[model samples]
Target: MSDSINIVLRFALYLDLMLLFGLAAFGLYSLRGQERVSGAQLPFAPLLATTAVLGGLLSLAAMVCMTWAMSGVSDWIELWPHIEMMVWETDVGLSWTLRMVALLLAGFAVTLNKRWPTASLGLVLLGGAVALATLAWAGHGAMDEGARRSWHFITDFLHLWAAGGWVGALAAFALLLRQSEPRLAVLARTLTGFETAGAVIVVVISVTGVINYLFIVGPSITGLLDSTYGQLLALKLTLFAVMLVFAALNRFHLSPLLENARQTGEHRVAVNALRRSMVLEFSVAVVILGFVAWLGTLSPEME
Candidate 1:
């Protein structure tokens, strides 16, 4: 039961941070100039501020949970010392401190949205990326020592960023397409821009994911099916492939359909088709994140 709760906390925190980073990045790259702040593109200030605040609070909860599980202390009096020691002495503690500081500054960044929109969003993106990257310390990479540790950590960071970017864009798309009267022109442009970003994101995720796997599981594929971690990873990879299919469909089929509908005056049908696919793709992405959170808790060898 405690393990389940820990997984839930980790999953929530992962989702929150990924969205916080991805959404900020999506706003910066997908939208242009006054379109960014006009309330027409995205409600940047309130949306980002809410995520930043939530991410920090969730981080605290997850940290406390980890401390409790590690120290086996029921009383606050005893747990307090353990918590303090972990916070000041360990690498996880340092990462948490940096993440909390970054999240706090993300709040301050949102305040600059009115006058310095670009800088504000850019800072928010940077903060979100940092916060997300720090989660690597809580993963399998943290169990390693020496130069392999650094390489693994670097790959983990890149993997997180790439995955976060893809997830964030899907969310932004679903939100935008959910409106009563979707903007066809803007949606068209955004989809095209996403095609470019999506390609890069896919490449980075694939490469770094392979590297991280090699670092953790080595060159062995024989024991993978016997381990719970590997089973979940297999499921994650299958879902990712499904997401890729949807992405290709969106790029090849729905996108072109929307373009044609724009000229033929049949916007409703085409837009709805694309919207359904986006929602489904986003749903699968969330499921994959859950598997990720669970896999992080298990051994990839024989557990």
Candidate 2:
């Protein structure tokens, strides 16, 4: 029961942080000058602020759960000292402290978003990145020692950031498509920009993914096939492949159709198709995150 709660909390925290960072970064890069101004385009500021607050709360809950799991204590009073020890005397605690601080700054930055859009976005982006990257400290990377630990953390951080970028952009695309009457030109530009960004994100995720696998499972295909961790990873890769298919369809087929629809002023069909694809992609991303949360709880050796 406690394990289940921990996984759920981790999944929520990961998704929330990703969306908070991804959405803010997308607005900064995809939207043009006046479009970025408050209320001129997508309402990213409030959304990011809300996500940051939620992520902060989830982070706190996750910490409590972690302490409970480690200390084997369910009573709140009994758990207090254990929680304090974890918070003040461990790397996980240090990382959690950093994440909370970043989340608080991100939340505060949202208040300034309307008045200082550019600076606010930058703050949210930086804070979100730091908060997300700190998760590496509590994962498999933290199990290692010396320089290997550093390398593992670096790869883990990159992997999280790249995944966040892709997931967040998908969310932005979905929201844009759901708008009452989205601007065709703006949508077109956004799609084009996402395509470019997607390419880079894919490369980073792929490279870091392979490196992470090598670190976690080594060069043994047999190890992968024989272990539960390997099997779950295989499932994750399969879902990722399906997501790629949807992405490709959006880029190669739906995107061009949107371009034509923009020119002809008959984009309803294209828009609906792209919207459906984005929804599917986002759903798969969430499921992948679930698998990730579960995987994090398991050992690579299936022990």
Cα deviation at 263, candidate 2, in Å, is 0.7
TM match of model 1 to true structure: 0.98
- lDDT string for model 1 (103-215, tens) is 99888999988888888889999999999999999999999999989988999999999999998899899988988888889898899889989999999999998888888
Per-residue error at 38 for model 1, in Å? 6.3
* Residue 219's lDDT in candidate 2: 76
Off by over 4 Å in 1: none
How would you encode candidate 2's per-residue C-alpha lDDT over 1-303 as one tens digit per residue?
Answer: 998998899899889999988988898889876676657767876788789989988998999999998999999999999999999999999999999999999988888877788888889999999999998887899999999999999999999999999988999899889888877888899998888899999899999999998888787777566777888899999999999999899999999999999899999999999999999999999999999998898877874
Cα-based lDDT at residue 43, candidate 1: 79
TM-scores of the models, in the order given: 0.98, 0.97
Q: Which regions in candidate 2 have their CA more than 4 angstroms from the true location?
A: none
Q: What number of clashing residue pairs does each candidate have, in the order they appear?
A: 0, 0
Using lDDT as the measure, the top candidate is 1
